[model samples]
Target: MSSPLPLVFDAPKRGLPPRHLADLTLAERTEAVAALGEKPFRAKQLSRHYFARLNVDPAQMTDIPAAARERLATELMPQLLTEVRSVECDDGATRKTLWRAHDGTLLESVLMRYPDRATLCISSQAGCGMACPFCATGQGGLQRNLSTAEIVDQVRSAAAVMRDGVLPGPDGKPAPGRLSNVVFMGMGEPLANYKRVVAAVRRITDPTPSGLGISQRSVTVSTVGLAPAIRKLADEGLQVRLAVSLHTPDDELRDTLVPVNNRWSIDEVLQAAKYYIDRTSRRVSIEYALIRDVNDQPWRADLLAKRLREHLGYLVHVNVIPLNPTPGSKWDASPKDVEREFVRRVNEGGVTCTVRDTRGQEIAAACGQLAAEN
Candidate 1:
């Protein structure tokens, strides 16, 4: 057996912005407003404006009194993300935004509109510390963990965009739609910033006038096999889906592909995932990124299926992602035939497997590609 690798979760040292409405609970927001020499009810009013109406500008907050609106906005709703640029593809159904944080940190979010539902992939941290050699964001290293509000605001902004019919549809015109799904498969390892990410999840799923009112079932949080954190999240009593980025199943290759595997091997990660399933009763998503000449061998697929069947049985599904190659990287997506056979072998091994739909590939929308260029 390999010795457990040391885990060093380091976030860049930086001052986060002052308190924002999304950062606080209703009770906390009430206290914050009271601290600003205002009545407690004012907090509810502000929450309604931000969370329900998705309006942040003081000038647009008609419900609040003219005298108090500016002060309230200034104190509680300070601007968090300034859009640096937006790129679109897939007949404008997919859009990616590069946002500059208040402290000038750069992060990105991708909004992908499908025929049935619109999904937004938002970042929990500016860059990643996972150190996966093939990932663009991981190659950059961690900048900082985004504040709770910073994380929630990305969804709020994307939701507002969908509601207002800003992005074009397959018809090549502005087609109004609703933001239906939110995935944390963006720039960082979400569970690494446990508290803030959990708080953001609450702010996302809680009912309107308190949160965006998106159903908890509509959210998916992905991790790179953080065993202890996965168990911790299961205990949170959330129905949100759990996705483990098991790039490879065998310990030897996984230790190189997902360095955290050295700390908690494949068996440990699978055990943790099973714990999550037992607690949440929701099927876990095993995310496998297939890279040519890397971890895409049919034998590995069979091994993955055998292990998953032993641990999770039918309580798990595999999403095989074709590697979205970064610039100048030797790693690339596997051949179409190889990908199909790999999926076939996994299914033959008694675990269901399917290819994940690759979206926004042209615009660098997949996982860590965006942060790599910026």
Candidate 2:
């Protein structure tokens, strides 16, 4: 049979059900509550539960009227996700959750508690369409883009876990009772789901009575260098960090590594990255996954550093990641010595560089692995 047609990038879309508070903007939330025959002030109280306190339980909303709590919760806070399974590793500091949505779609997100902070890696789509050959999620193909509420719910749940003292750090503390950072480098190409992703960012950064109060600076939105989208985000004037997953420096090899590079050349991607740096005054992060004998050469390292110097200037930082190999894939991480050499060359060229810590490998918590099994 012929392959089925793919999802059109620009087709008019209907979002996920409104049970999720994250899908609604502040004004929308006000209107929804007002529609429920409640006063406008109820919207502010609901916002506090969803954002500031990070709790959605009607029983805990003491400030709200006892008679009105059940009605409000039923109308505003229907559960969107059911936990499928949770895998814990790193001596219990890291936990990856596989969730089944209300529609029975499987998706994954991770919560990691560190000494200083807790971070959550959230997915933007049910599966990915990017089709990067080395990636497991790419092989599965796209299921659909997640709604804004689906994406934000991941953070809300993780934040609630941290606050409840369920996740502990090395010192056995409750990891500060708040989520410190959020990374968008999970399953999908976030920029591909542009409107929802941007909406999610606003929900995450807005102060209480509107959305979650997380600092915009603490959020990192990653993409595989969607050039036009990169430029568009720069115009947003928000301070959230931007990460460009430039797996390889040269277009000749990257064309195979990241197929999207075929449409937008490396030069165009870097130039767009420069615009982000100039506009936001925030350092752009370059994520390079080190694979054995491929894109791991010292020469490629030097070229990567040189390119950053030319296009990004001082507003760039390199995060070299050890490739987390799929079960039967031909690829594996580069040798430690080679990995160190790659870092050395990039630093010598006068750009900041470091190897990213590889975590949750045993449970397939690394990027591109979760969606593979689902």
Candidate 3:
């Protein structure tokens, strides 16, 4: 067991984002519309345009009267994210967007187009508070927690781009498709921005006209061993998969690699993961970044497998990611032979494991590469 979490996790909130339609629930939208001297039905009309139709510009909302469009849209749908620039790789199959918020905060999101489905990796915070030395975002330190609207707007923008064929499909040509997966694996330790992240998840998984209508099962939330937050998320009746970024199995190295481990031991983290499985009945994912000899040792592989089996049994899957080196970082990915042996030892020890298919390294869109730099 580990000691209680320290109270110094959250960074100071610099500025609160302006209110937007994505921030409010269905009932709140109606109340706001009535308060603005508009008919209650206007709320549903505005929501359907923004959520279902992916239209945020008031000019395109022809359903509403010309006289009322500006007021209703301006008050409810203020633009939250403005595209700074986008870089693409993999024959246009992967696109990373740099966005500037209203307060000039920079954050990044990546959209990858696969043969069958598209997945968007969205950031839950402007930068990270976790202070993991190997990660680019963590090295920059946390800017602030994003508002619920800022988080959800990233998903909304990705869905719109996918629908509009902005990113090329498998054949190197533009083809419209639907976004099927969302991952909270960019820019931040999601659990540190707990409330807004949970609200954004609800808005993403809720029904059409109220949300983007994505399945809860298709979404994933990743953290670096925030044990109490893990338990809090499990009780929320959500089906989203929990991904723990446990780069190492032992506390000695993990305390330096993942700074949060100093607060919560590996045992406490896995125990919290076990509680999550008990509540959601979902297999938790263990994310291990294999960085050369630092954490790719054969003995650590066995220890990882043993620890997972003792706590989670079959309710766990391990995803070993080859470390994506950031600029000027000493960390390098483990050699292919070493990575293979590590996978072999883990599976031999009874826990199934696979290497992640890395993408967008050329444009710095790969795992742990997002710094949201200008």
Per-residue lDDT over 12-59 for candidate 3, one digit per residue giving the tens place of the 0 to 100 score: 768867799999998999999999999999999999998899889899
- Candidates 2 and 3: which is better by lDDT? 3
Q: Ten-residue segment with the worst summed lDDT in candidate 3?
A: 1-10
| Candidate 3 Cα deviation (angstroms), residue 164 | 0.7
CA error at residue 87 for candidate 2, angstroms: 1.0
Screening candidate 3 with a backbone cut-off below 3 angstroms (N, C-alpha, C), the clashing residue pairs are none
The better candidate by lDDT, 1 or 2, is 1
Off by over 4 Å in 3: 1-8, 367-372
Residue range 28-74, candidate 2, lDDT tens digits: 87898889898878888888888878887899999999878788888
Query: TM-scores for all candidates?
Result: 0.97, 0.94, 0.97
Estimate the overall C-alpha local distance difference test score of candidate 2.
0.85
Off by over 4 Å in 2: 1-15, 173-176
Better of 1 and 2 by TM-score: 1
Model 1 C-alpha lDDT versus the unseen true structure: 0.91
